[model samples]
Target: MSFRHLPSRALIASVLATVMVSFALRGQDLREADAQAMSQEAYEALQRGNAALAVREYRQLLEAHPEMVAARANLATALVSLGRFDEAIAQYQMALKEEPDNSSLRFNLALACFRKGDYLQAAQRFGTIHNGEPNNVRIATLLANCELHLRQVAQAIALLKPLEKSHPNNLDLEWILGMALIRAAHPREGLERVQKVADRGYKAEAYELAAVVYMGLTDFDKARSDAEAAIRIDPHASNAYLTLAMLDGYSGDENGAAEEYEKALKANPQNLQARTQLGIIFYNQRKLDDARQQFNEALALNPRSLLTLYELARVERAQEHLGTAVKDLESCVHEDPQWLPPHIELAALYYILKRPQEGAKEKAIVQRLMAEKQQHGPEPSVTGSLPPSP
Candidate 1:
């Protein structure tokens, strides 16, 4: 879930272009003299970080000589630099049409798709490249990331397994593979992978991931230890304290949970999850004012957050602000119609407000959602929900 440690696709593309430009152009048919000169100027603009100028020049060159594959490819890279992913995708596709076997074109196309949030297409393209070049660890890693986002955990694990064997020291591979395993309900395997990374000197992020894996396995003591290790390695890691706080809450230690949550917020004030969890603790303890403060702060950070709205509604209801609570609940339900808890809560509130028909409608939705949950298995707890007591 954390790509923070990985080199960005843009950086990867730039490096690839630098290393492979000559190879990519080798044996290609020559463009006209004017087109070739314009392409060189565009490439120089790109090198100078003048992405907009590069894009304009490339577009003009492509307009004059649409068959110029290198110019089209360079245009795609410039568009990518500008964050114009859809435009970049178009240019890459056009370039690929001229040279379908070109690996660099295919890779850049896949990266453009990924940036556009078209993960399915990106995965398919990356998979095609991987099939042809299995030793390309970067492509494999990116393909695994696409699988993780698509929730194809088994596929991600399968994709990374052999690579992890060949490149045992790749901490990013281990981190992503561990997370995929955890999401696939193989927490023990995930824990082993993360712990191995931690033992290999990637203590901070590795221990943080290990703590989350332990929490998934319901090994609170181990989770606490890993969290503490993560904190000791990097005190500014807000996730470490958040994991510790979650462990504290699960163990019925509200005070300890609150303390850790506060520490987490202090470490990273923008940690919305920590603030939301702390608010839930306050709500459970009947500290309505304290709960509202945390929830309001979270709402200020993300005004459209459904969990914050739902929690803030609870606070408003506890304080007898019926109108405000109703408004908040209505907004929550509107934001996520299939969320069962809000429907149930809204139904009760509607009944109290003498809106019998609306209450009945909400209650029916709750029944349908509950039946669906029964078929699928238990729903995962959302933010602002209390942890099950130990």
Candidate 2:
């Protein structure tokens, strides 16, 4: 009668049926004991942070009692704790089917979707939850994050503004709102919001954000000061160094920018932004070897990054390695066909290499993409260069 003896699903179902029926007909507490014990064991495993064990126990319980919403919910939670987002999503869906009105189960499902990088589904689910509970700050924040990932900047800002008003001085909300505003092209307003946070004692992150805004505004001196202040507050803040490097590049101080980028990388070696920007600075300086090294490292980190590929191609072209440049540009174009810059560059390279037919093909694509871009308004500049002075 050991629980482990019930190996097959049919066996588990038969045993569960017998246990329930015997308990009901005989009014005997003994028949119900095994079922309660298994549930308690699952709870205890979860309490002890053994998510794998908890998942196993919950799954066993679920197989025996497929209609038990609590068991499904707990299994979903255990799967989430184990970083099994797809499985968690399935379990949560099952729990929701059993209890359609369960807000927590729906939220968990949305969270799993978000974690799995399905921003569209996450946004839809979070939007539904937000509609049901408009005052839920957590849901609003998560929904805004999904919107941001989907490049719905205006919608993110709209969602965050009310939360900012209701929860004044809340650092996370203010920070997100400020970033949303900046992304929405309201840098002045964003800077003011970030400045307010900094003045209110969130100096480190606030200063770093303000520095980025100042850099976008082309106020190099102010950007430098704010970035320095961020570094002073937290020397290991990789973003502060990266910002300083970008400001230096904008100010035509390539050497200083390179040094700052190195510092940023030292603080956090995985910072692809710092690596990419440093490569751009080196490329601009005509230091092809240095630029190639940085871009190659960045490409290793993010193989499909079109910007890195383009920059790497540029370096190869500068070094008169036309073949390598063509290969890189081909890869870049393959990754993003509508990207006009790579097509433009590739056309020129083809013409230079005496490949007139290939050149003409790329030129045609360039014209089409340019026309499409004009019809849709200008694409956002992803060149990582500083904005022109006003």
Candidate 3:
């Protein structure tokens, strides 16, 4: 129902006219004393780390006083503490309508979106907030983080570069900016910052990043050393394990690579790259079912990943799901016309499906892409290596 339709609810107030009331009295249609006591109890629940109890109390309080913005914001915080991020986001959003300029509500909403992996949404909100408060290091750092997660390397670099100049010795800013620099293909500069952060005790993450920088520089020995150091500092360093796996795979030690990949997944089951790489291993081993499972899991983590989509399409085709494979391959082609691997796969599929015309069209695209590649020579890999040569 439209909120304007509820005049009775809107007009219901404990005091006939009071603009300078207590925080609790702002929205609840309750006597001042009762509102104070109830809100105080809810606040205490939050302070005591009893979010479930706070949620219950806040729900009861909001029931009789649906317009209570303060109470609703507190309720949203409680929901976030209890890992109910979606519920928390809803409450924050509703409260924002009542007080559109509430920074706390907007911050919490962005935080909830970030925690829920909606980095794009979180980035937009954080960007606005950061623009308004240029000196707010926390907000700027978080916005940079969101950019990194979204693969907007240039944006992240722009946000962090100025911060690095202003706060030269801050390890947090240095490490993050280092990562952005590396992604922006300035590995030599990136490595210097990462080394400083590592020397300053952010060993695990910095070492992991240094390993990647070394890989890009083709210093395999240094890459192995840094990766091993990262793992020693934190056994649960899944990315460290992933780096070691890549090293082994590149060295032609398939068994060692598989073991490292397994360890990486065990440390972090949600590591999408680890899952996808292991799936490729299974594919090379001719274990179609296992490869399919891993590809599907990676897709769940990032449904729009053309790499995963193409991998899954190959598995589907091998399993004789030609129609499904065709759809996925076509989607990949539409999403990235210049990408050659999917075109090659689609050409083979079209031929198998007895569509000579479509196959010839795909072949033509592949030929054009190859010509462009030859003219351009080969672009350097951004992070260590390219996708496994289709």
Model 1 pairs in collision: none
- TM-score of predicted model 3? 0.68
- lDDT per residue, candidate 3, 82-191, as tens digits? 88999999999999999999999999999999988899999999989998998777788888888888888788888888777778877777776777787776879879
Score each candidate by Cα lDDT.
0.86, 0.85, 0.86
Winning candidate number (lDDT): 3
Instruction: Kindly give the stretch of ten consecutive residues in candidate 1 with the minimal lDDT sum.
Output: 381-390
Clashing pairs in 3: none
Considering every candidate listed, which one attains the maximal TM-score?
2
Off by over 4 Å in 3: 1-40, 59-73, 83-133, 146-156, 198-206, 286-335, 341-365, 382-390
**In what order do the candidates fall by lDDT, top score first?**
3, 1, 2
Higher-ranked by lDDT: 1 or 2: 1
- Winner on lDDT between 2 and 3 is 3
Stronger candidate by TM-score (2 vs 3)? 2
Q: Total clashing residue pairs per candidate? A: 0, 0, 0
Sorted by TM-score (best first), the order is: 2, 3, 1
Stretches of candidate 2 above 4 Å error?
A: 1-28, 31-37, 195-207, 225-236, 280-288, 302-311, 326-390
